[model samples]
Target: MGSKRRSLAAKPNKEPKLSRTDAPAGLSPLDWQRGLRRQFGREQAFGLENLGSEPFFSEFRVSNPVSKSSYRVAIRGRGPGGNFCSCPDYATSELGTCKHIEFTIGRLEKKRGAKTAFARGYQPAFSELYLRNDGKRRLHFRAGTDCPAELREAAAGLFDLEQDGLLPEERFGELERFMAVASKSGHEFRAYDDALDFVAGRRDADRRAALLGQVFPSGAADPKLLAVLKAPLYPYQAEGALFAVKAGRALIGDDMGLGKTIQAIAATEILARHFGVSKVLVVCPTSLKYQWQSEIMRFTGRHDENAVRVINGGRAQRQKDYALTDFCKITNYEKLKPDLDLIAAWAPDLVIVDEAQRVKNWNTIAARALKRVDSPYAIVLTGTPLENKLEELISIVQFVDQHRLGPTWKLLHEHQVKDEAGRVTGYTGLEKIGQTLAPVMVRRRKSEVLRQLPSRTDQNLLVPMTEMQSLHHQENADAVAKIVQRWRKTRFLSDKDQRRLTCALQNMRMSCNSTYLLDQESDHGVKADELAALFEDLFADSEAKAVVFSQWTRTHDIIIRRLDKLGLGYVSFHGGIPSDKRPALVERFRDDPGCRVFLSTDAGSTGLNLQHASTLVNMDLPWNPAILEQRIARIHRMG
Candidate 1:
């Protein structure tokens, strides 16, 4: 039998074996015969063993006679690209066949007749579902002759089989039904799952493309909308406004000092003019309520001065404010719970949430309250939307579009990388998540739009006073008011009275920073907390460094303590530090990678070349604008 097998293999190369039609395209009959001869030689030379059981009957183990090596070949289906072999030649050669596959095929052909072998290798064409990105993006279905009879009957009226089988974009419900039938009937539709994924991906891409067209109609913003705005928007800001309007609900997570406030205002205006989005509701930090009101009044040319109302005071007063039909109403997040029903009743057309990271924890009362407001349009503004974890971002995004990221459990399962102990170690599939968020979330770093930014951009962040700080501030402020009133009435001041007035004013300023700065005891103050929060964000980026200036050395002392708690490195430059030692401190701040902060009193504000710092923070405002400019110039000067 062995000699007969060897002679059979050698005879194929000498004779004209099969016709030219039997060979694959582009091969001569003699060449095809020679190739068949090599395969026959391999089949006879190697040892073939069945790896699969009688019922499973697909896998075979082919052993190399010379090298003593072996490979497993699996018969998946019929013909080329159907079977798989654990061989380098099969993987690298695009022909989709190897010696192992040929040997397996020869065994099957011998067991079954030549007619049955040929019939098994032939695969008929089947129905295919694919995406076509022509003038209109739509799903195209091709019904082949081999399409299942049950699938065709199920899709009889739903799809036009006589036509090109073009599925309308609006008939996705019918498409889902058809897919269900096809899936249940076990029909072999090519690219079925991939077609579904393509539909979802194209939905997001369509949204983005539509927004782009609206934002850049004729390659620019609508002139009519621009005419209604009091202030001219930077090109990117205008795009951001239109993006928010186009998304209907979005998260504007531009970096700090990037004018998220202006973008939100612009979006509100665009919605008002183009989409009949009136009754704007601005929910922000308590300290920024007035700022929002001011911005609305400043930028909204169509809205009068009386059109914007800041909701504050007690419940009755807030309810009255909510009752008003003002074009814009601004309120704080803290009041959401008490006035939740009132807001629901008011039903503003658009809701703007500033510093939206406050709602990063979706389970929190503030976040839930904001989510319950149920506005048609939402613009969430946060400089640091994702401060710590992936969940924080998901939570914030939930407020804008609940279904944008799909279910929380599924998202975490797919992206969250866990350890042996089930603790989350890191994340994966971030690029996919980003693609999912591209339609609803708009985040721009300062570096991305650097050309549109001015040489210097100034932003004033109003930090609310803590409970105790507010009490102390109110007391000193009242005392100073009394002193001023008495001086105005009499037009004269005694030395003791002037001294008392100065003390009161100074005490009020100190209380704004921290009670420790005033009494050297209490550490409760919002400014220091806000500074620490800023540093937390700044230091998140390795390249970020800041020059923090506070006029009072005592303020620096409190901040330094906080920095120590955060385990951040810093160089302090104040009058207390000897002049001779200042340069070395500067050198350390400049050269040391660990030092991310340059904490300074006003003494080092001038004549310092600390251009390495990308950010500058003022703990408290200076009395003179020149002094503020000097503090900014320390980092903002020419490189």
Candidate 2:
């Protein structure tokens, strides 16, 4: 018999580690010190008082000549260990050194040129480097190796050098030309274009602020439309609308419960009235289609006949609606593919895509379909634009303003950190990305506008598992482990095994809800009893209402049974119900005072108005934290 051979998968390639000497190799301490002196003059380094120390250790209060930020520097034993600065540059660099360290070493050593430090054949070239928003809301520049004193003085004269940074933006042609001519000997312009872009954006923001004051003195574009709005917009909402108008094509990335919908509505009115944009297309989650319709009517005071049309019905009806060109149209992302050609033909002046993260993956059919449609202005709305990687942000940005960010390749290179072998290690230059996004994105947090929002408190309640629940959970876990073992032995799992595995996990989760779910026995789980008792107490005291969220309909079913047993008036929403009936359910839950509880799965979480219910209960938690936020938002949005 032939011997059995074990198959193994290939291991991933390892990235090369950087050496301590690689950055300043072939150059001595003197060369590095000279480079430092050229970048930040001798006076700034020695201007501070040196706090006395022992032979091995010393301290100094080094002040940043540009930013005027003071930092303490300490030197340890010798070489690399002795070179330490409190500044971020020293701590973050792979070389374990900074200009501060070089300056200190230059002072410590008495005979600067006693050793053969400066190489005879060494040559120097000038390169201009610009760092954007280095957490100081200021731009920093580096004039590069052996750069002339004339250009350095010119930069300091043109722009106020804050500690070691630049704050002013004006004519830099002379500086740019000098750097270009000097760098022709072979050096790079480090983030020079990005710096220029940020300067122009700042100027635009100033102009935009002035224009918005003139346009919306009383808040919204037209006071009559503002009068029609269901509730007055908070001050921040007005600011966001004005920002969107200035951006033309933008992304509203405000956190959930900050009223992105109302802000988008206000911006839409501005586009129509100011820019002569008559046709508007709104693409949103299927659940939110009617919600958008309701918001438009409430805010615009435009009835269904004349103002907003939600594209629905069968293919023929959808075609008819798509053909109509005058009014604002609302549709879901899923419907875009089926009626892509007609929607494109409709030729919307502005397109607003809600829950915009749905298009994060560019390879999806929906994303590709949305891209094909031609719209002069587009605004995407999402609380979490980047769910995982930087690529997701790029995808959303590409949809909003494709040219402003330049090529995807260039953006990725600027932000993504890579190791020696070209593997992505991590990310950097976040502040730079923030600067680029400043002009085209509006972000607000609930914490910043705390006065406008109600205070919230969170409590965690734990219920012990019942004996029956424990037994079922353990049994299913063992069965799942055995199945996994079999799959390992076979090196593959069939569709049947996959289904079996899924069902096994589902059984375990259901067991958590109630062992009765799996066994159909007379006895119930402790969680159900706890849930029953809590609602019983809440009802006994006051007229309280809650929106309870769960991941499974089976859980919802068990809760419904308990609520029924408690004689509590309750409503339910889940995937099993027809989509057309959901609106009625939401309305009943919202308006019906006697409806004490709304039982729902994940489907009830998005774009629903249940703010009348002050409390939220999660019977079972979803895997993603974002889903929990969405569920809470249903009861937490502005009136």
Separately for all candidates shown, the number of backbone clashes (residues 3 or more apart, or on different chains) is 0, 6
Candidate 2: C-alpha lDDT: 0.68
Q: What is the lDDT, from 0 to 100, of the residue 478 in candidate 2?
A: 92
TM-score of each: 0.65, 0.44
Q: Deviation in angstroms for 318 in model 2?
A: 2.0
lDDT of each: 0.75, 0.68
| Residue lDDT tens for model 2, 1-639 | 899999999998843332333325565543443354324422244545478543224566667667777766654423542234666444323234456755655554444542333222112243344433321233556555565666566556655656544535454434456445445544444444544554555665556557656766764445643543556776677778767877878999886557788888988887787667889999986656777888888787778574898888899999998887656898888888999888878889889998787565876989868877777677888877666678888778778865445545446656888788667888898778878889788777666887865466454445546677888888989989988999899889889989989888888888887876786664557666656755753454345688888787667777878888877888888878887899888888777777889988787556677877867888777678998888888787644
Q: What are the RMSD figures for all models against the true structure?
A: 16.8, 21.5
Model 1: lDDT of residue 463: 70
* Tens digit of per-residue lDDT, candidate 1, span 336-380: 988999888898989998887756577788877876788767899
